[model samples]
Target chain A: MTSAVLKPGLTPSRVLIYAVLILACLMYLVPLVVMLLTSFKTPEDINSGNLLTLPHVFSTLGWVKAWATVRGYFWNSVAITVPAVLISTAVGALNGYVLSMWRFRGSQLFFGLLLFGCFLPFQAVLLPASFTLGKMGLANTTAGLVVVHVVYGLAFTTLFFRNFYVSVPEALVKAARLDGAGFFTIFGRVLLPMSVPTIMVCVIWQFTQIWNDFLFGVVFASGDAQPITVALNNLVNTTTGVKEYNVDMAAAMIAGLPTLLVYVLAGKYFLRGLTAGAVKG
Target chain B: MATLELRNVNKTYGSGLPDTLKDIQLKIAEGEFLILVGPSGCGKSTLMNCIAGLENISGGAILVDDADISQMSPKDRDIAMVFQSYALYPTMTVRQNIEFGLKIRKVPKAQIDQEVERVAKLLQIEHLLARKPGQLSGGQQQRVAMGRALARRPKIYLFDEPLSNLDAKLRVEMRTEMKLMHQRLKTTTVYVTHDQIEAMTLGDKVAVMKDGIIQQFGTPKEIYSEPANLFVASFIGSPPMNFIPVKPAGGRGRWHVPLATDLGQLSLPLAAGDADLDQRELILGLRPEQLALAAEGDSAVLQARVEVTEPTGPDTLIFVTINGTKVCCRLAPDLAPAVGEMLKLSFDAGKALLFDAKTGERLARESKTPAEGSAGNVAQFRGR
Candidate 1:
């Protein structure tokens, strides 16, 4: 009776398709279910029960300890990811508007150079970026990590926004110009209002990227300024400690929850924005 | 109302590339409607953009009220344009789109509301003021686009094929509305379109352009009746003007083309042209409406077999062979002819135009259109 299933005599291929879809969904969600169950269990319960079993007498010891250990660094992650996402997305929108609309000589070559940055490996810029950060006396600080994430995230954000804005009619810009709107006014009043879907995609993408980033966080920051990802890794891999699997699961859950929440809340818009060009109005 | 003039304006995208607009010259009187018309890739739209200051001309001056505005930006130039796409701001309501320019100029809030009200009422879009452009139909969007321009009392208006996107019924309705609006406002306006019907029905002055050059600039009647060259004559008519290749028969500024007939070839006398026409072949230009069914035992009629007949709602078309060229004659629907029947067609000898076969220039340059009291018709016609 459902609308989406393949109909008309229930062919063998349809059954095979439904089988594969269900199997893939379980494969993805199995580890997440295990992590959530373990995070709510005691050390004894985690060791005794299997990955799929419910907790034997629920406990809060792992979550409390994990929260105590990573709360400061969790706040540090917020400080870094929030500013990086906002600044990078804002700057990318402006960059895209200028590059696509008010083009001058060599703008194409300049955009080509910017696109080159998108494919460059993060390891390729680690040394030079660190040296520059050191020269500016921002090394080993949360500000340094924020700067690094913003710089690295700009390539994708600009790409998303530029591709989105190109579909907008150029006549809109010309009409606004004839209506006496200047550059920033046109961008803010005319263009930006129509960019909500793309903005959602960029924000969701940058939140997940910056939140899960280990390379920039571990390299450019340390000590009191380390983000939650670095703290989670430290908690899981400490050499002179007991192997607390429950605590490690709780910490991992803490580090992964923000991205999960973003995808769950705004996932449909993200998919729509990605496939916007596939079908036209 | 304002007078707009362009003195030898030229535009090129790059140095070595061919010019997109070449040495354009136009002078429009106060409150006159000038229509720039041509096929696509001609420089009519480019000329409109230059007048709106959206594009910078490579050379020459644009005079508005006899003061040069070539260096000003689009906002400073005080001109508004309606794009062919009706580029209504997708994010703004109709009222806000109409009020955008006035708000940018820092007009008072009360004055801006009044201006928006006046323009919305004039365009009959007061019902759509609260809705977005995407919510309206194509014709409604077109009205909102016009309202956006009319809200600003600029010196001149530039319309770049504003009705080109509408359906046939809507385009005709909007065309009549456009004429009424222009008459009521009496604002200096320059419109661009490739539709020859729009050029004929809506312009006080029309400029037909091709290949970055103004082919002919005159009134619509002059453009229709007496074109300056072969391109203008051919491009300005529906079903097009027929051109027949013929050899001249006489000399001493009096020429006639030899047309092939059933009995034999007959000399069709045209206006007096120079002896140079007799030295080379000539192209005879005639419109479909100019030819009619010959009366019984007409002395000067050309005889040919009707090859095909098309019965349109208003008029029937008769196709016949004239000097080995297929020519169409428009007749009353009641006067339909059968195929393969012998038909005699008579045309006004004086209305026929002669052009050089090689150069496409009009041969009778000195002849002008007849005045109201004069019996002189074609021999006294003037050309650009």
Candidate 2:
């Protein structure tokens, strides 16, 4: 008798949700499908408006030529992103620990300034940042791009973890203090271990930002140091031959894959980390 | 083992705000269990936090073993606190949480494991070692929290309403376990709780506080029977000590307290040394259990209409009116009286207390000469 109600409870929400979800999923997938089909097509197939069709002759030439000519820029993206995520996450955690636990004069002011960084548009800072990087001898190198990624990433990552660590009961920290743990000890042993979800969120967010960056690479990097975003743009709109849309699509997918895998793997915690201290209490 | 003495300690959040702990003076002997009992926001938790070094004292010295530790960091205080929320590291398993303190102290891994196992077994959380705090029930979580503190073997243990979150049966069981553990360990401990029964049963000495000031500091029995003031008297008892405002109508030689009820005027006997009676405003404090059904002729007997009767299995609480004030009489379950019926109640005047109604100060006078045969075990109830 209870199963009668339980049946609808389980099946109704799932049925309705899955129905709408599948339709939504298809809508999202259509663009990516079109992009992939274009990436595989010859310039003629793309111009002919046969965009969503399979290649008449399946070709790896676009992939081969793109990899040979444009793969360094892809490597440049990896170079910029990996170090950027690592540096920003490490610094952000420290910033969060300080903001959450310690009380000092102007600590709140400093945090307010960092939060303000999140609201500022990249376009507003682009000219000055470019000039600053050039003056600092980091203009077009992977290091310059890394510095930019880390700068922008810091605001979001610090804000993410600052709020995360704030909800960790102050009593636990006090208990640790009475247990003979110092500030760094508590942060390393207690706060850091509990910050897995928040760290994953920061890492995924920063990885996507740095990996999918077009503006920074365009403004900063002039040559071989340009990232895959620059490379993908160049592939689609080069001055030489007609664009290889299939290769462009594939490269875009490849550049986006790291963040996709991150979300797919740690998606549950990512969602949890985003909405912590909401209903969980 | 150490003697903890708070000498004129005062804590204020800010200059303009009232003090949270006002000129608090207490001396707890080595291995003595001192229970700070008070209502919420009465500064019991604040006192505990100050003692644990979690909160800083605004004035005076807090000495442990004759050494001032007011400025010491919480880590240097050798104190372990079991918080009201349990405050177990939610991410860690029971075993890990217990071992955290030992690990911080750089204890050898083997010793940490052994100590963790010992406390886990003592708390009966051995089977829960692998489980996270979220997996455990509230009672189990409370045990693990206690285990974390016990693993440290610190100079003193502080419990801030540790069992308050548990259900009734579990709270009673935990109370018993706590008493037994204190007996076995003999660790100097200070516990803060609002439950008067817990305060009465657990502590060698109890400090009752109200509005940031210690109302009375004495053994549980003392606080119960000879509360320093009207507030303490009223706060300590279960159905609560009934306070009936009375006036000293007659001169000292006559010594009378006038009753102004429908039952007719009755003049109760008063003690000789009630100097505050000159003001004609005094409060009569009668514990519910002290008032009894007048079986036969008894001293200080009065007849009043029973307005309410509550039979609570073991005893019946009978409410009656005396001089326009509601008075409670605790009678045996078999002696339940019908509501609206006139019930004659008697009280031993020796058990009654007089307080200055305006100031809430005790009159501090012996009511009657001790009975010849009944030398009075009542003093035993004073300062247990």
DockQ of each: 0.88, 0.74
Considering only chain B, report the TM-score of model 1: 0.94
The parts of candidate 2 lying over 4 Å away from their true place are: A1-25, A41-49, B272-276, B366-384
lDDT of 1: 0.87
Q: Per-residue error at B161 for model 2, in Å? A: 0.5
Give the DockQ of candidate 1.
0.88
In the range B248-356, model 2's lDDT, one tens digit per residue, is: 7666555678765577556778764545456568898889988887876576677788889998888889888787788888899877779888777776776778877
- Candidate 2 structure, TM-score to reference: 0.92
Question: How is the predicted docking of candidate 1 categorized under the CAPRI scheme?
Answer: high
Name the DockQ score for candidate 2: 0.74
lDDT of 1 by residue, A179-210 (tens): 99999999999999988888889999999989
Total clashing residue pairs per candidate? Answer: 8, 6
Go through the candidates in order and give the C-alpha RMSD of each one to the true structure: 3.0, 4.2
The digit string of per-residue lDDT tens for model 2 on A179-243 reads 88898988898889888988888888888888888898999998788988887787667778655
Q: How does model 2 do on interface RMSD, in angstroms? A: 1.0
**lDDT for each of the candidates?**
0.87, 0.83
